[model samples]
Target chain A: MQARFSVDSGDFTKAGSASSAIKRMLKQLGVKPAVVKRVVVALFEAEVNVIAHSYGGFIQCDISPEKVNLLVQDTGPGIPDLDLAMTEGWSTATDAVREMGYGAGMGLPNMKKNADSLQISTAAGKHTEIRMSFSLKEGEDGVS
Target chain B: MAFHRTLKVRENLCKSCTHCMKRCPTGAIRIDRGHAQVEEAKCIDCGQCMQACPHHAIAVEQNLFEELFYFEKRVAIIPAVFFAQFDDQYSESQICQALYDIGFTHVYPAELGIDITRLYCVKGADCKPIISNFCPSVVRLIQTRYPSLVPHIGLKTTPSHVTALFARLELEDKGVGIFYVTPCPGKIAEFHRLAEAGSAFNGVLNMDTVYNQVSTSLAKNKRKFAKEDGAMSFPVMTGSAATWALSNGELAGRKGRSLAIDEIHHVMEFLEFLEENEDESNIDFLELKACAEGCVGGILTARNRFLASERLRYWATSLPSELPEPLVQRIMKQKDAMMDKMTTPIHEVSAIALDDDIGVALYKMEKVRKITDALPGIDCGLCGSPTCSALAEDIAQGQASIRQCTVLRLKDPKEVNTLARIWGEKVTGEKGEGK
Candidate 1:
């Protein structure tokens, strides 16, 4: 089954709530703790990308006995320079956002670091989509 | 050891995103039980977790202000920046009295310690990038990540330490009480360390706590205090002294050869600079600040208009720009004095254990990476972990399980389930999400 959440931008006070929610949901299942932590980091990085650097976006997730998939779609200004944005220390957030400790330019790189077989498709004004896959443990049963 | 609640985890507000783990310098938070919790020893109390908790659920403990009234004198030694919170209404002089009227026996301005900082760092070393040793958080980072450069840190303890030292020495006979008004959680952590088993200061009062008390008084009465000359004994030589309250203030204050940097992102360059000290003498001190603009604009302060911190830069610059005691010459004598103090018993955080068994940790980290890689990259905090890595860590630690994800997991009985269904099919399910 798939679930969706609407994350808002400019509301730094509520920035990572969506990511936190997803982490907890996966934890209740018989999933490995290590994989859960990585997905949470990647997802939170994307959420920050939308709020700090773009318009608010939505986080779409699909879960099953096999693996979990997360998709983040945003209406914000897509990365002007993907390669640069993908770089470790490059960021466009204003000094104000940086003060909040939200823009270290580590968001996309961190997401890519944590996600498996990551795929991202972003256009300047159209839309940006990021898809990631996480495999399940072998011995674990699909009780859900 | 894990707790039913090591730290507060507001599950309803979580979105299960992974941003927190990415930002977590120490990887302390883990997702489970529909929320994230602090991994005690793992949390350095840098308050990055509190800073990143968008839902306001994750917060440092509140203060015992009203409760303090029952004990004794309530002297709030507010950081200098706290003076700026009241706009032009509360300048240095006026507010000292305001604090007096509002249940505090006296208000010890922490900026007073800036004089100690100024007196201590002046003279001696010229053009040798001296990192400011005033922020305990910055100091802790040194201990945790840059142990080799421990020798380079200014021998003087941070301003807060100096303040604590001064408070005890100066107030021992005064018979009055003292409290530290904190703007950052890092300071609270410092206070925790300082005030632990063998301690100094009495208590730490956070900004929110003091703000509540001050706001009430300001709203009720507008009486300003006396305009005493140098109401603050801080030897303000140049506007640069004031700049210390803001970012890059140390750069402006240095009278000798030095470089100034203010950005956490510049850690790599800093490491390289430390490695290759080319212009040896021309760079006595490196006034490196973690925040981009500087201390006046820290993670804990109120969010102002765009670049509002610059206002402090201009205002401080307009005040004056002369250190009472010049650097270069003074630092020479000060260095000898400090050298003895440098050897003083102080904890050194191990920085960049480059040769440590990273492979072991990496192998451990990879397991987490694998699980998180499959989840939504959206750091919504729905999973209660700060990020996906945190959730995976929880699972690895056995604190949480993956079946908790109702959003991604299949319903009750399902032969049609994705992960199990695929895993049951052998080759197709070998590496994918299994049913």
Candidate 2:
């Protein structure tokens, strides 16, 4: 099964729709509650990141019996320092975003912690793409 | 332990208006055939269904008369809110004596246990926004609806259970069976939980049932228990802690960040906010009540809750506090006994388990998403469902079809027919006559 949803920057109202949809899907598929929670948490942070930092973005999720792969591609000023952005407290979110409690600099770190495999690629001043994969097997660590 | 729920619907009284179907916080109610059915797996037994039913179709389970006789010595434990229902002239001792006249050998008010628990709560809590565990319904809400915030809920046994334990300790050798005269369905259900864990409480009697009998006995009997000048067993805090029987009383006194939320919907909304805003560590205490005005506004209560709360304010304020030294010693002793193992943690409830396999459920949800996107988002409820999303869930589960949605059927009949035919083929797994 596959799903694609568009996310507008700073649109908090619709920010969680994609993550919620995928959560419902995973729940229906009979995934373990803990696994579904982890996947949803990772996807939510990724979705919120796209909406908070990027001008606009799209979320694509592909679910198989064994695993789930999520791709979030955003049209925004790409991360200049990937290593710094990966830090727990480092954030480039605007003041408005911070007031809405969106940019905690924890989104990437959280996504990394929850997802088994996380890959990132970006062209500065252009765009950013993130790929996260999660294992569906019960009792297994998220990435492997 | 086996799962138990107290809420039930009287099919004869149901009009099938779907009022409860839309209002359920857990999405546990479904309109099947003609009547509203409660899905037990998802139901937290919050008594919201009983309140929503205009026809009075919903009924809660209570102890039978014979169940009370089975116990050797029946002791009634009353909630502090029960005292607020009566006229101010009736002292607390008179109320306890009145309960004694109604089949109970002895009566113990819940204030003693509540005081001890509150003292421990104010002193021992380490986390911010310490969620109150006073309401059993609120505890069940955390178990099913907000599992992640379970740790934040303060460790404390309900006043009823705590009082029952104390009563058992007092009657150590005798076969003493404690029974709570409760005002809400949630506490009635909590009785079973206590019994499962080998508590002294034998069962619960609905406050409504005992109220009429006790009222009659109060009018007839002139006898009253010996009244003491300082009857209350806890220290008087100027702020609302003494009046915790009232809905917002939990917020009285103590300076740090605190919140007292009442009613089920407001509690859900606040909890959702707490879940999202993870950085809010400032709040030191949170008091969440399931009923509109705490237990006084329970479904089984006869008095007007607003009036009862007003009456309680006067009584709670004028009531005297306990003597300092003995009370302090009692708090210390109870603290050591209740440390670490306060209230029993409820098991996680999976209200909605769509399929046996994760991959299959995901596949079905994709189909549901497709169906939802196609339907009109007006939420008109013309198709017997409260919202378009609900219809999509039902359709995905093979309970309904897209043709039932009047908007799609009227505005674009062709689209509806095409979608129906495709859905039919998918369900049957074969080429249909239309194709």
Candidate 3:
């Protein structure tokens, strides 16, 4: 099964909509609670990152019995340094983003920590594409 | 899968008006065969249906008043809100005396257990944004709808149960029948659930039932008893415990950044947000209740919620903060046992999942989505279901059919009939009537 949701840039009000919808769908599919939580946490972070940093983006989710794959792509003023962006407290978020409680610099770190496998491709002045996979099987991907 | 429920529908009294069906937070009620039916698995027993019914068709199940005679010692565990049900003219001691007159050998305030829970169970929670399990309905709601958040629910048992445990220990070796006088059906359902797994109390009584009996006794013996006419001296709780059933009651003196959310729908919306951003939110404690003004707003409550809450708050101001020394000593006697009992985890109820198997659930979900899209967006509720999406879900589960949608039937009668033949009419009113 598959689903797609678009995220408008700086639309803090609707940042978590996609993640919430996907979470509900996964729950209906009887996915383990821990796995669903992981998916929601990772997807929410990625979704927020798109809204807070990029121009706009869309999230695509593909679900199977054993795993879920998510692709988040955005028109971005992309990360100049991947290592720096991956750090826990480093951020390029504007003061406006910080005021809204979104620019904690923990978004990427959270997504990396929650998703079983993550791959990101981005460059300065180019679009960013994030690919994350979560294993749904019991006792795999630390879900049990 | 069988569970205890305190609310039931009287078929004779139902008007099939769909009021209860629309008010149910869990969408557990559906009109069937010209009467409202409750899907037990989906019901959290929040009493919204009971409050919504115009004909008083919904009834709260309670132990008979005579059931107190089963034991030689009858103890009534009364919530503080019960006293607020009466006018200011009725003193606490007068009410206590009235309880004695109504066959209760002893009367104890339910919030006395709050002190016990605080001292033993409220500290050292590992789950960030700990959800309070004080409201049995909220706990059951989380268990049914937000199963993933079950681990976040604090392990503290409700104050009433804790108080009952103390009562049991104090009255050991006696033929004691401890009854919880509850302001809501959720508490009764909680007692029943606990009783199924072994409980400290013997039975449950609705607050309205006790209130009526006490009112009658008080009215009959008006001006007959003195202000302090040998009323049983129960332990007085701290001011916090006195107002603990009101909104924001649990967060009064708690540490950390805590939030108190009341009313079931508001609680559900917050829980949905919290579930999606669990790791990001820094909340330390949550006090969620199904009733708007907490226990005072319970469907079974007698007085207006605002008046009762004001009365309770006024009463709390005069109370002392500390439990009396001897009362603390009595609680200390069973400290080890009470603490052990309070630590049991609440398990999740996977009642809302579409299917036990992932593949089949996915297929059913897809079908529900398609059917939902095909149906009219306006949720008329004329088809007995609460919403179009609910009907679609029912159809996917083989419990309903597309022919039940009155709008679709009105729009394309021939197509609807053909679909009904394929789907096999499941609803009672969907039979061939040549519409």
Candidate 4:
């Protein structure tokens, strides 16, 4: 199964509506509660990243009968170093966003941990692409 | 959806023009061929489309005015946001005259309902985040979108629910009629769901129905009603009580370092941002309102002129009426229990855990990720879902295939072939049959 997302640029006031829809769809799909939790957390983190740093982006999902797939793509400023971005404490969020309890560097890492196989492709001047998989095998719950 | 009272649409009366789309606040209308089709997902029940349609193609389902006019004992349950609409009129005075002139035995402002909400949410001002239950659409929005955040909503029953309970209790024997003066689709939906659960919800009147009638009626009979500081409707009514209807009333109501976010998307976005960025400077409480301006600009309001923030501030300051000591004390107390009651996920139920191979799931994901690599990553929703992941999920669900996504098709002439090639398996037969 494939799902698509539209990450509207930050009006700050209207940010999380898309993520909310994703969470709802996850519920309808019978995604495990723990897996849904992980997806919500990770997807929300990526959504905020687009609003705060990039021009705007989208998060789409493909749920095969086997695996759950998520792709976060944005036209925002891409990360210069995949390694530094993958770390948990590096963020370039504005002070206004920090006032609201955001811009922490945990976005990519959280997405990585929730998704079994994570892929990142970014161009500093162009865009960033994130493809993550949360497998649905019996022993595995979700993204863990 | 079945809860709505059916209305007759004059079929041939439609001009088939796209004029109504521009007027709809929630984008509920779309002109197809010649008739207008209402998108259920998008419609907020705000009558802007009706006002916009020149041919009068739109009408409300089950108007309460018909029932309200016939009832023996009718009560007007006004939303706290109602006070915000008329800046010049005094709410205490108008409420008093309104009850008497409208031929009702009592006048209960939904503000009293807020008192009940405060009683439920405020005591935990230190730890619990209070998502306002005044608007039904916001709650449903969260239920559908931010299912995980469902836990964060205050467990307190909405003011409407409490008011419905209170009204039934007050008029035990009398032939009773409860007419809710609604501001938006959220309240209308709440009344609908509440009825589906039992059969208590009586009638609802949008602002367009009674705004003018009430104002004219009150003006005509201002002399008969006695008005000082009227009675409190519930336990939690406050100096800032009406503020709860607008942009940041919840923050002001709870008092500690609180954050109030209105507009459904704004609240969710802030939630996502708070999750990603916030630190030790924890927000003591959170207030969520779906309508940008609180309840006043609901799908049912008479005038849609004022900004939600400005009108909210205007109404909150106008009323500081005195309350009875017992009522004051009752409104001040906090509810002990948490609001987010059900933590269970609402996903699909599978019988024996069919596909449990993490390695296989991972490989399939990698293959899909690679197959769509060359497609434009734009989630334009041209393919149906609002995003790309939804389309992918649809593909996985068998409702749609990868070939349908133009972006994926652009990347490779044969999208399914590409997916099959990446997975190193034959997937064409039996269509997604591998268990």
Candidate 5:
């Protein structure tokens, strides 16, 4: 099964919509709760990252009996330093964005902690595409 | 497996107007054979249907009034909200006296149990943002819909159950009957579930039933009770216990970052968000209730919810801040036993899952998505189902047929007929049509 959703740039109010929809689908499929939580948390962080930092983006989810794969592609001025962005508590968010209680610099790190495998493709002046996969088999990643 | 529920629809009184079907939060009700039918597994017994019915067709099952005579000593464990049901003219002692006149040998406020649990019961260091299990309907909703969050629910038993246990222990040798006077059908269902697990409760009496009897008794002996003293013989409760059934009542003095959410729809929305983002929210505790203003807004309640809540809050101010020493010592005597019962864990009841097997559930979900896309987007509720997606889900589950969609039948009869033949006419009244 596959589902796709678009995330508008700077739309803080609707950042978690895509994650919420995917969570509902995963729950209906009788996926394990811990796996669902991991998927949702990672997707939510990636979704918010696009809305807060990029121009605009879309999320695509592919689900199988054994695992779920996610692709988040955004049009933007990509990261100048990937390693620095992965560090906790390091952010470049504006003061106005910080007032909304977001941009805590936990997005990429939280996503990396939740997804079983994560890969990023980006340049200083190009768009960024993120790929993440979550294994659904019991006892994998301590899900059981 | 079918679970016990208290709400029922009278076939004779149903108008098939689709009022209750639309109001159900879980989409549990569906019109069948020109009458409303409830799917037992899907129902959380929130009483939304009872409140939405125009013809008064929905009724709550309760123990008969005469059932109180089964024991020599009948005790009524009543919530403070029950006293708020009457007009301000009726004093608490008058109502207590009226309960005796109506055959109750003793009257005890249900909040006394809250005091006991507060002092003696040791809470477990379970999941974060512990959900309060005070409201039975909210607990049922979580069990049926959000099964993953089951670990987050507090394991402590509710105040009424604690009070019933206390009452039984106090009168252990008296052969007493402990009856909970409930302001909602959910409590009756809860009592039944607890009774099956060897609880101390004997039966449940609807608040409206007992209210009518007390009103009659009070009216008949108005002059006789008017001259009596205003003092209450029953044990008094702490101020917080008096308002414990109201909205925000449970979170009044609790420590840590807590939130109290009332009304089923709002609670459902918040739970959906919390399920996904549990660790990020930083919430320490949650007090969720199904009714708008908590028990004061129960379907079985008599007075206006706001007025009743005000009365309870006002009454709370006149009471002591702490339980009397005698009451505290009584609770201390049974501390070990109460802790054993209170700490019992609540298991998940994943009733809403499409299938127990993940692979099969995934296939069914894909089918449901395809069917939903083909159907009209408008939630007309003309096909006996609450929404278009619900019908799609039903069809995928082999519980309904595509031919039941009146809109599709009207738009393209040939296409709908062909789809019905492919999907199988499993629905009643549509059989033998596609053959």
Candidate 6:
């Protein structure tokens, strides 16, 4: 099954709805609590990143018997250095976002930590897309 | 031993009014067979239900009064909120003396524990949005509901544990039993968790129970303590620490931004805000209290919270700005003996899952969603569950049937009967007896 949700830029109130909806879907699909938690955390971080940095984005998810796949694509000022952004404590978030506790430079890092496979494709001053997959099987811990 | 909650329901007092089911922050309460039943796995023991219940059915477990006599040396660890419970006629010393007069070998003020916790904890050291550990209900909420945020909780043992352990060392007697006078069921639950870990406290004494026991003489009682009256010993913790019982006291003197939130529902909302926003709030310290106005608003307390807050504010002016030398020296000396880890590991409190198997849980979720779409949106709680979604989930799980929904039955009898027959057939493999 597949589901898609639109993400609004700078809409902190609606920032988590997409991730939360996906989380509910995954849990309803009978995903393990541990697996659901990881997916939710990863997707939530990805959602916030798009909201904080991008003009807007959409979350596309595909759930199968073996795994759940997620694609978060955004049109905004894309990352100049993906490696630097992935590094912990490295952030280009504005002071306003920082005050809200969003720009700890840990969002992408957290996504990487919880996702079984994380792939990011971006071009400077254009767009960024985060592609991640989480395994559904029990006892296989998400990639740290 | 695994963590077990102490909050209980007296079957006779429960009217099955669903008052508690609506109030519970975790959705842990449900009406089963004309009685309010608490699903222990999801209950955080916040005592909201206890206060909400008009019948006074909810109660927490505690050591019997007769059991206090067994301890060779008994000590009463009193909370600072206990001082505000009295009129101006009674002094803190007088309450300490009255507790002694009431057969307690000694009275140790919880202020001492507050001081110890404050002194040792490094506020906003490494973890941002650091949560206070003093409020046991808030701690339990984080543990059960927000397991991901467990690392953010302050790692300082509560003052009760510190004082109890410190008293054991000072008395040099292993048989010295420490009894806590708590304001809410959550604290009692904390003691139960501590007991599993072999804590210094031997038992818990309810504040209302002890207040009634000493209310008569606490104001009138007098005792002289000019060095020679050695048995009339009580720890003197006169400082800003006395204000620790009040809301936002933990955030006092902190350099960074912070919030002091009370009431269980607000705490839940704030935590959700934190979680949904990816923990980005600038608040450094979150002094989250389950009660309305911190400890003073606890369900078991006697006075009004605002009145208590006023009294506490007036009392705070009289306290010393710094800790007394003796307490300072004692805390410095025994710092090593204090608990290094304070946050209690918690399990998921939500019972939203339909089955252990992911495939089965998915099937159940679909069934529940379909059932929920048909039911009335108004969450009247006539079906025993707190909300319509909850009732739908229950029906999908087979713990309940669609017939339990009085609204649907009355509003659309034909649809109700048709749906009930379908579900009944699914369950029994035959035609169902229509309601």
**Which candidate number maximizes TM-score?**
5
lDDT of each: 0.58, 0.74, 0.87, 0.59, 0.87, 0.78
TM-score of each candidate structure, all chains considered together: 0.55, 0.82, 0.94, 0.61, 0.95, 0.82
TM-score values for chain B across all models: 0.69, 0.84, 0.95, 0.64, 0.95, 0.90
Q: By TM-score, how accurate is candidate 5?
A: 0.95
Task: Score candidate 1 by lDDT.
Answer: 0.58
Query: How good is model 1 by TM-score?
Result: 0.55
What would the per-residue lDDT of candidate 6 be over residues B21-140, giving only the tens digit for each residue? 998998888898878999886787788898889999988777886677888788888888887888766666666667777779978877787676666763422577878888888887
User: Which pairs in model 5 have colliding backbones?
Assistant: none
In terms of lDDT, model 4 sits at 0.59
DockQ of each: 0.02, 0.44, 0.78, 0.09, 0.75, 0.30
What does candidate 3's lDDT look like per residue over A1-144, in tens digits? Answer: 889999999899997899999988988888888888888889989998999999998999998878899999998878889999999999999999999887888889999998999999999999999999998777788475
Q: Quick one: ranking by DockQ, best first? A: 3, 5, 2, 6, 4, 1
The model with the greater lDDT, 3 or 4, is 3
What would the DockQ be for model 1? 0.02
Worst 10 residues of 5 chain A by lDDT: A135-144
Model 2 steric clash pairs = A28-B361, A29-B357, A29-B358, A29-B361, A29-B362, A116-A143, B129-B283, B240-B252
The 10-residue segment with the lowest total lDDT in model 4 chain B = B342-351
Worst 10 residues of 1 chain B by lDDT: B1-10
After superposition, the stretches of candidate 2 with alpha carbons farther than 4 Å from their true spots are A10-45, A87-110, B65-72, B89-91, B117-130, B173-175, B219-242, B251-256, B277-281, B323-342, B373-386, B398-435
Q: Give stretches of model 6 more than 4 Å off.
A: A1-13, A24-60, A71-132, A138-144, B117-126, B219-233, B330-353, B421-435
Estimate, for each residue in B20-81, the C-alpha lDDT of model 1 and write its tens digit. 54456656665545456566544544555555666665655646676557545455666766
